[model samples]
Target: MWFFSIAGVGVIGVLIGGVCLMAQRKSLFGVLLSMEVFTLGVYVVIFSMVWFLSGLNSICLVFLAFGVCEAALGLSVLVSLVRSTGSDYVGSLVLGHF
Candidate 1:
């Protein structure tokens, strides 16, 4: 049924996000990627719920706008940090570096 399909997608998203987050130990890029995966999962779940409740509307649009902005800002910051430090390793970002 449709309900099962939705739940399956939600579960898959959560699993993907969890796996990506676990990979974050390798590099800052991994961390960002994982966060994006997690965000995707959140979006999927929210949109699904909204779709079931009231069809589509401005709420989905607003959530999408904010999600895009968040991802952009996060990636920009990551790029800046990498450029300044010459490395994407998580530990490279120490308080004293700033």
Candidate 2:
């Protein structure tokens, strides 16, 4: 069924995102990228739901807008962190450094 196939794709996205999030913890950029992947996975899942329901399709756009906003905010934070410490490494942001 097309439904199952689409859902499977979404699940794969989620799995890859999770793996990337876990494996790419070295830098803030990596983490942010992984989070984007994870968000995209969720968006795929939501879009699949929209595919089945015609009336609720607008929700997908709302999610996309929010995702963009989140990404922009995340990039700003990463820039700030890197500017303050001169490095994007997670270890550079240890608690004692504050």
Candidate 3:
């Protein structure tokens, strides 16, 4: 059951990433957001697996730290994009060197 749940989450994350990639076409913000979502899903799945297999311990702290860093970097990029473009709409910016 746990294995199935993890598999389902992984599949969903992959689908979301693929769709986002297709729609946005190498968009940095889109790719970042998709990656964040994928990362969160993977983290949850991994944590659950860890807990189920070995019970919780200090090792989980590593996952927590990674998630925090990923979120922080994502947010920083978002803020930079907003500040530079004055908007969050990806369509407004053209592809290529910014």
Best by lDDT: 2
Clashes of each: 0, 0, 0
Candidate 1 displacement at residue 1 in angstroms: 2.2
CA lDDT of every candidate: 0.79, 0.88, 0.72
TM-scores for candidates 1 onward, in order: 0.82, 0.88, 0.63
Q: Which prediction has more favorable lDDT, 1 or 3?
A: 1
Order of models, best TM-score first: 2, 1, 3
Q: Tell me the tens digit of each residue's lDDT in model 3 across 1-98.
A: 76778767867876786677667754567777777777766766676677678876666688778878987887887788888877767767867623
The 10-residue segment of model 2 with minimum total lDDT is 89-98
TM-score leader: 2
- Model 1 lDDT, residue 57, Cα: 73
* Native-to-model Cα distance after best TM-score fit, residue 93 in candidate 1, in Å: 2.6
